[model samples]
Target: MERKVLEVINLKKHYKGNKAVDGISFHLNAGEIVGLTGPNGAGKTTTIKCILGLLRKTKGRILVDGMDSTKQESKYKLAYIPETPDIYPMLTVWEHLKFIALAYYIDNWQEYGSEILKRFDLWDKKDSLGRDLSKGMRQKLSICCALLHKPDVFLVDEPLVGLDPKAIRELKDAFKALRAEGKSLLISTHMLDTAEGLCDRIVVLKKGTLIMEGTIEDLRHKVNAGEDTSLEDLFLEVTEDEKE
Candidate 1:
């Protein structure tokens, strides 16, 4: 059996009168890539925030590596990339990587840094300040920072928002490499095409509730769609079911 990297049981997050994450639950396995998706106001971001412990869940459980996130901080075992890039605008690329290495307490960062930067096509701007880089470049820098620690679980939100075609391809390869290294990911995105290519499984959410969760093939079957039907089509089916 695949090792469970993360799990949420009847997870609920209340924002005043709104039940932002209304009793949604799911589990992710090691080496698995799970896409969390839905239309706007579907609670995708809220669920991610709850998983990261950035927002407290009103009820139920969120277990990361078998540790209750509220009781213990196991953040060192995981990495998170929010919907928007959040890196120091004043820091140079090399300095940001160095800061990450220190934060992760990894001493042998010189070789690792070079390899990752080159893979992301960021070697040329290694000394560029974050404030001066293009949107795509800055996104790459955040991605590099997230991976520099080489944690077991990655939580990414809207990772492709600013990436170019080539950079997107590099990112796909990088995610595959991370999975090959026995890492798992929980990605939240509205980009169906990218999610279809990268996710091993998927979970659909609508109005703060889970609509479906399964492998791509399994999801296709659940939607009663043909094997060739795209994720976008299947997404429509799931959310439509929620509407009715």
Candidate 2:
């Protein structure tokens, strides 16, 4: 049986009588990439923050490799890439990589770090400070940092946001490579077509509630869509509140 790398059961987040995430459950297994997608305000970010232990959940359980997500040890087993790349303005690209390497106690990270920078086309900017880099470069650097230690699972939010076409292709290939190596991934994004082609399964949320979870074909069937229907069409049908 494949091991569950990430699990969220009955997860809920309530703030001042406002329910951001209301009891949603999902799981990602080793070697699989699941898309956590929905329209804006669908609680995708909240769910991710909760799972990453950035926000305390009002009620629920999140397990990372079967360990409680609130534990520091559990955090070491996974990585996260938020929508906005957070990097130190004073740190150079290479310095950022070194920081992650040292923090994780990774021996001989130079070769791996160089390889990652090259793969993301940021090798030429290794000496550039974070503040000097463009949005796309910063995003790439953030991805490289998150991947430096190679955790068991990845929680990537809007990974393709600032990437150029080439960078986007490279990042998608990287995700596949991680899956090939038995690592799991949970991706959240509004790019339905990319998510459609890359993910094995998708979980959709609406107004803090999970409304659908399944493969592309399964979702089409659920929405009574034609065989040729695209994921965007299916999503529209599923999330529409004005359906006749």
Candidate 3:
């Protein structure tokens, strides 16, 4: 059997007196795409931070490819695209690509970089300084850097915010291509339509607690919703019940 690409057990993260993520757990197998979603302040980003080892977890464990994510502290095999593109003001777009490719030890970076830039419609701006690119273009550059490595897992946070319609279509296609290569994706986004269209499974949270998780059909049934229920409707139904 293919080993689980990622696993989380009783994951929790607390800040001061409040819990940002509370005892929520899930797993993603190779080729699976899971959408981690909820409203603002719902612990979606918090859980993502714990997985990336950016924020220390208060409790529980996360294993990537059966390796302890905390102890082993593996860096590669996972690629992350944050909500904001982290770019150096001085580096040209091509420079950024060279830096990321070197960090991942991928030779023939010129060849790989061109492919990504072309795919994201960013090739024309290859010589532009990072600070000079448009927001959408910058975001595409960030994605290009991550994909140059071809990591086993891709973790993205609200990736659709700055994308134009064409860019959005391109990104969705890229994710599909990666999944076809047996990669796993754990994406945290508030765009319900994209989540509904893209994810193989959906995991929802409210105030740090897991309120719903499963395939779309499974989640709909869990809430006794209609078979054709939309994710937006199901989310409202599930979250509304939590308030009562």
Best by lDDT: 2
Clashing pairs in 3: none
By summed lDDT, the worst window of 10 consecutive residues in model 1 runs over 69-78
Ranking by lDDT: 2, 3, 1
Candidate 1 residues lying further than 4 Å off, grouped into runs, are 71-73, 104-108
Model 2 CA deviation exceeding 4 Å by range: 241-244
> Model 3 compared with the native: what TM-score?
0.92
TM-score of each: 0.91, 0.90, 0.92
**On a 0 to 100 scale, what is the lDDT of residue 201 in model 3?**
96
TM match of model 1 to true structure = 0.91
Tell me how many clashing residue pairs each candidate has. Answer: 0, 0, 0
Error of 1 at 214 (Å): 0.9
Q: Output candidate 2 Cα RMSD.
A: 2.1
Q: List, residue by residue over 1-244, the lDDT tens digit for candidate 3.
A: 8679899899999989899998999999999899998889999998988988999999999988888887644557778988888988799989999998777678887997898888777889888999998767777788888888777898989988877898788778878877887989998988888999999999988899999899999988898989889999999998888789
The count of residue-pair clashes in candidate 1 stands at: 0
Please write out the lDDT profile of model 2 over residues 1-244, one tens digit for every residue. Answer: 8899899999999999999999999999999999999888889999998998889999999999999998889998889987788889999999999999898999999999999899878999999999998776777788789889888888889889867887778678878877887989899987889899899999988889998899999998887889999888888887675355
lDDT of each: 0.85, 0.89, 0.87
